[model samples]
Target chain A: MREQSRGPAFMRILYLEDNPLLAFHVEQMIEDLGYVSAGSLSSFAELKEKFQSLQFDAVLVDIDLVDGPTGPDAAAWLQKRGIPAIFVTGQAQVAARHHDISLGFIEKPISPSDFAEKVELFRSRSTGS
Target chain B: MPIVILLDRASKPELVRAELARSWPRARLIFYQRPVTAVELVSGVQSALLVRLRQRDVRDHIGQEMELRRELNHRVKNILASVTSIFEMTRRGATSLDAFTDDFRGRLRALEKVHSAVFHAAEGAVSIGDIATLTFEPYRLVGQERISFSGPLMNLGRESGTTLALCLHELTTNAIKYGALSQPEGRVTLRWSVIDGVQPELALEWKESEGPLVIEPARAGYGTRYVRSALAAVFGRLPTIAFEPDGLRCSAQGPLSRLSATDSSQPR
Candidate 1:
């Protein structure tokens, strides 16, 4: 068994996804990357609250949340707080708008391989070492 | 000819001296302040000419609007003609009551759904989600318990959405009648991919496992033929189909440009 790193050695990820099944799958993917899923929130309110309380290395947000507000709105809030976020959306048009603001985009049904690759990319940029 | 009237310092004396009311009674007049110098006079003439040109521009605009309206009417008529022809052909080909009703209603709904999507989409592009929702609404209602969908959100060009929706509907119909949705335990996996370096293609897998074992039909029916033909018509190319022991697998590949064109002149 691979030894688990105790603290900040593993990247901390804050993932906001609406679908429970997809959220679980993504959380598992985040864990497999030797990263800690700081927390996963489904609603905008919870996501905002978690962001305020936690120090996440990066965030992966979905475009359409089951609740009201959009993923970009959450990303914009994170941006105001100086946190880096990438949009994980199935909608190509929605992703296109993030060309200027986001770190990058990950298209959905959230393929395991694609999710892992994007997480690694975010981790590299956040550490910069 | 339209009359011109000038009013200026030089003309002021003439207007004051002459019978102003009588001279202008029946004449259409344009008034201008008199220019002090030769250069000013030339500039006044140019300005007067520009006003006449502006009037001509208004006339031209009216003419163009008429032409546009005519073209729009022509296009609408053509769309109706093509839709009528398709119905006629389908009616002639359909043998039984069930086949005719299924094919007719399915095709009409497909056309209606596409029309609605195009109407709503602003830049000739519709969200893939909208297309999926519209096409699958009927199936979802009919097979509420059986079928489920999972995929990344993707948008296709408005015209492409229409084609994609129709193709999906046809596939769903086939599954409902013979494949997965026919049984209680079976399901479909619908997914798509957009690779950066490669041409964008949509892959939809209809896997029907843990249900009744599917035996290949002795011969392809009108339902199968219509599904194949409709997909071909949309892509403007032949689609490939594989008969697996588990379920039916179909793949379609084509240029995105062909799929994206929104010109209604193109046949649906």
Candidate 2:
């Protein structure tokens, strides 16, 4: 890791989960971990409408969304756009199949420590550490 | 033409005076201790009354629209949370890659199936038999006679119906895998009866027989867990699942009144 400073500045994250309730719950956790929750959307279509204007740093996605199980495709789309993604899912085994598309995974019913550590990993990956 | 009107100083003149000046600038206006005539005084009061009513109507409309939006947001959140919970929990039992994908997708479809049934009902309630029929429809399309569903038209609340659908999904899937539906000669009988009283209760059973010999799994899986967890909340009772030599037998009973809904706040 490069010279670690208070240099890992807070950045905005986009949430891609079909459940609005989970999104609302996770948004609180994101803020608590010192990141801004850019916004949440259920479908890839909604994400497309939002992504351009959002200017977010990273993404946390679920495997199943409003548009069905289109989450892996969303992660790939984000990767192509030079934005990083992490699969936040209960189906870690399923997410592991698409490991190349995302920076890492954060299992669901998220523990604060795991979330903090994984977010740090995202921070490091984005900051080129 | 200039519509000149004199106002009484004590008759709440400032509001009307300012509004008139903005809307009809060329008109002359004067405020006096007393209007020169009662006609002008009455006229000014009437205009003020009209503005007040209009303002109130606008405020009321805005308030109502905002309330509707809030309600929509809340329902959307609840559904999302439920979906997330289902997805999270279902992953526990999947074995092969195809099995995981198929199971998760099937459960989601079950939820969707119940959602539509709830929507089609006139009230935010559905019939238990309706739930059974719709769930068993695909099977029927293939050939409906193997499974027999017998129940009177007893109302079910939307949420309870959803839970019941999920349970039926587990029951149906398990039957196809290991119980009655596995063999050509296998069969299932689903029936429910309402015990009427001051506090009504519904008694339900799922009995499968004549498939391959029943062998109990060493461990419980997603479908079984889903049935146990969802019913604990929906019916406040844990259902019994048995591995009889003939087939699997599942049964449960709970207060019927909770499943009967007259709620009408569902957004179409």
| Cα lDDT, model 1, residue B35 | 51
Tens digits of lDDT, candidate 1, B207-260? 555445777788765445544544544443456666677777776655454455
Q: Give interface RMSD for all predictions.
A: 19.1, 11.1
Please write out the lDDT profile of model 2 over residues B1-268, one tens digit for every residue.
Answer: 2244565556677788788889888644545446366786677666666666777899999998887895576466556656666665555456777988888888788888989999888776888888998888766744359889898888887767877887888889888876789788889999999888898888898999888888888987767655654564455455787889998888888777545643333433
Query: Candidate 1 lDDT, tens digit per residue, A37-72?
Result: 765565566666545567777788876553443678
Best by lDDT: 2
List TM-scores for all candidates, in order.
Answer: 0.51, 0.60
lDDT of each: 0.63, 0.74
DockQ of each: 0.01, 0.05
Candidate 2 per-residue C-alpha lDDT over A1-129 given as tens digits, one digit per residue, 9 for 90 to 100: 344553544678888875443554566567768788776766676688667767787899988764556889999999999888898876678799999998789877666688888877777876666
Q: Model 2 chain B: which ten-residue window has the lowest total lDDT?
A: B259-268
Alpha carbon lDDT of residue B83, candidate 2?
69
What TM-score does the predicted chain A of each candidate obtain versus native chain A?
0.83, 0.90
After superposition, which runs of candidate 1 have C-alpha atoms over 4 Å from their true positions?
A1-129, B1-54, B198-200, B233-237, B264-268
Q: Which pairs of residues collide in model 1?
A: A90-B153, A91-B153, A108-B152, B5-B30, B128-B155
